[model samples]
Target: MKHEDMVKSLSERVPLLKKEWLGIYRRMGEHPHAPKWNTLCGDRLFEADLESVRSFEGKLQKERLNFRELPPESIILWCSEMERRSQWFESVLNGIDIKNDWCRITPMTRRDMQSKLEQIVPLDADLSRLVVNPTSGTTGHPIPAPNHPAAVGCYDPLIQYALRMNGLNTDCSGDKVAAIQICSQQKTIVYHTVHSYLEGAGFAKINLEQNCWRTDESSAFYINDMHPVFLSGDPYSFLDYINRGIEYRPESILSTAISMEKIVRDKLHGYFRCPVVDMYSLNETGPIAYSCPHDPSKFHILPNDIFVEVLSGTGEPVPEGERGEIAVTGGRNPYLPLLRYLTGDTASMNYGECSCGEISPAIVNLGGRKLVLFYGKSGKIVNSIDISGIIRSFPVYTFSFIQRSDYRCTLKIAAGGELTSRSAKFMKEKIESLFDNEIKVEIESENILLKEKTMPFICELEL
Candidate 1:
């Protein structure tokens, strides 16, 4: 956008964008790419929201009872509102009382979200403020979620809380850039913007790919020049960032999109001399939990609004400390009010006091989502998320892509409709192109690609 239009856009979204920050804002425009600021609180409501998060953080630092079933305060009112305004909830709660017999109500699945979103969203939700976030992070199923600007902007405070828990009290204010979300994708958008929530500290999302910059060294130069206090990205991108040999030292790195293995986490910390936090997040639900600083195996739930639960195969709530599918209810996203939404991920819930002193329940033994890597013909590393993006376009309920040690790939897809040879061939060719046509690919139709859980990406190559 032109400088005049950019100014108007920024002014509308962030009414409080500081006059001093205009220099950094203008500087951001001079970068290689144009800037895009999708969501910020329309007014000064973000100020009150930030204060609320501060109060919640104070409570978070104290020991308290970890509620079982539903979070007591939010459940009743949320259910009544959903029943009154949500078509899906109204039908599901036809005769069942969610308050007294919450277990009787069927847990919402991703399939429900995929097929019946219009009915699920509350009728009273403000459509004017809605923004769609396209996601296929897990399960290889692309579902676009509706979000609001204020809710998306709320992530800043929650992120700050996670950083404080990790023993890094950061200052992402003034003229300094607060953070950069780096990506290593073959294709992605790169932009920078000043956040009103961070008091005009700049934030950028840049791709580490060679073509993104004028020269090979320009990527490193740009990052060092920005000098962001911290960084955020998936494990694959972080690895790519390190491999590219960027010399900028960040206070910490927040890893999300997929579960980070211990080896990768340890390697990141060792290289950067910073805490590498594994955050369990989804585009559908925003930020869910962050890895406990005291215990790597445990993830402390982040937002106070959501209620977390573990459900058995039959959808019954499992006994505390038992392994089951992770389901969540209630979130800050006004456009998407979730009720017992099954995350399609597994973890055992722990209600007892944690060693980290976070009374909010911790999800232990989290499983399902993982960081898997593939190799291109030119020895280029491929991330699972990219592969997921390609396959998500196909007519498949779910899929499993496996790369054997020989680099031969096999895609087993549970077809959403009747599988045709031509479509399968196209899917096979797409997978081959992802590997630069270096590897052979076989497309197979399966009645059920997933068993108890979905492991969409698997690699056997030793690299």
Candidate 2:
């Protein structure tokens, strides 16, 4: 208990050294490289191009990577290494001599885990194996993910490395971070305003939450004074800042907390005039993998920290190049030991050798949880993301379009900024081009989860 109290106190005083103190304790925690990564983390998001980041649709259909390439004898060694990294996970997955409260807390399902989240994860508790297990929430429900400090050791470093892949924070850096949709200890609110999260102590860069970026002089204070590296934004903001009356460029391009289409990414690249890259991750899971600059064909898993499996609906492992559900074996957060955990999303592996040439298995065609895109006058055809590419050209990110009726299509968007004549016309033209003469675009901007209140990419009207 004395050690626990001492470590917690030290963490609060020195946030940067959080993980190190946890490592010294009798009890071990998970979330390898968490404190270190969390510090470098803290940024906003937007979507990216190709409907896919690294893989092409044609190749994902033809090739998938195989797990057989990995050594079978590695599990024992891997377990040992993981024990050093995430003791909480090691205790749960592999039997450990956890006879005390320090390591033997019963794992929780998403439901029972909430109340104890903070109790388990003390702000001062670095990596003493007492992380609040976060739920993957993929069973259309949540799984209890216990916090792991050691996992963060490597996981945090991986984040910094991936950001460098995009040329971010070489020298210029800041303290402020932004988010379009922020989930705190409280409710999920559309993090539209920059000042909402900014209290007395702010970071060095701006974490631009999606909503409306204030066009006032105070925004200029953030631009010139804070000089935040713009983490992410919609193409509308990245491209039409001239209409927005501010011409600020960020140091790096951090994409994906929201869905930014290929069209928008092209414009964002123009606006930042830098390497704009997107990563695959969710709020529950920190950045899991990244796009290797040398290979746009596949994603390299942070294999040092995570174990990923592509499985079919029946929980059977799918062959390379075969579409299947993504199952996560190792999570950076030991508080969350997501073993054989099913992620509702779908994807495949790269069977072919990647042009970039990293030996890590290339993950391609993550295709689950997607709304099937249907088009043509009678709505008789299925377009999927391929035909739906043009739909992403709009400024608003949250939207659902349907054509149950022949000529007319109902366009529902999450509401944020009230559509002016200019914005509305832009909306109508986009819908018309896709469905043509009979197409009618109804800007419901409501109906779905409130856009102003979310960071949902494209909440397609479920067919």
Error of 1 at 55 (Å): 9.6
Per-model TM-score versus the true fold: 0.88, 0.49
Clashing residue pairs for model 1: none
Best by TM-score: 1
lDDT of 2 by residue, 1-463 (tens): 3766755544443334324323322111121211111122211211221112112222222332234323223333454554555544444545543222211223322232333344323234455444442322212222234534343333233444555655565532122432121121111112111221121112222222223234344343444443344444323334334344445566666554333455666776676677665566643455556666665335666444445667655555678788876666544453554444445456787644455544456677754232234455555432333223333334343445555534356656543355465776775675466554455656565644432212122323344
Those runs of model 1 whose alpha carbons end farther than 4 Å from true positions after fitting are 9-18, 29-65, 393-396, 414-430, 445-452
Model 2: ten consecutive residues of lowest lDDT: 180-189
Alpha-carbon deviation at 122 in model 2, angstroms? 16
lDDT against true structure, model 2: 0.42
- What C-alpha RMSD separates each model from the true structure? 3.7, 15.5
What are the lDDT figures for the candidates, one per model? 0.77, 0.42
| Winning model by lDDT | 1
lDDT of 1: 0.77
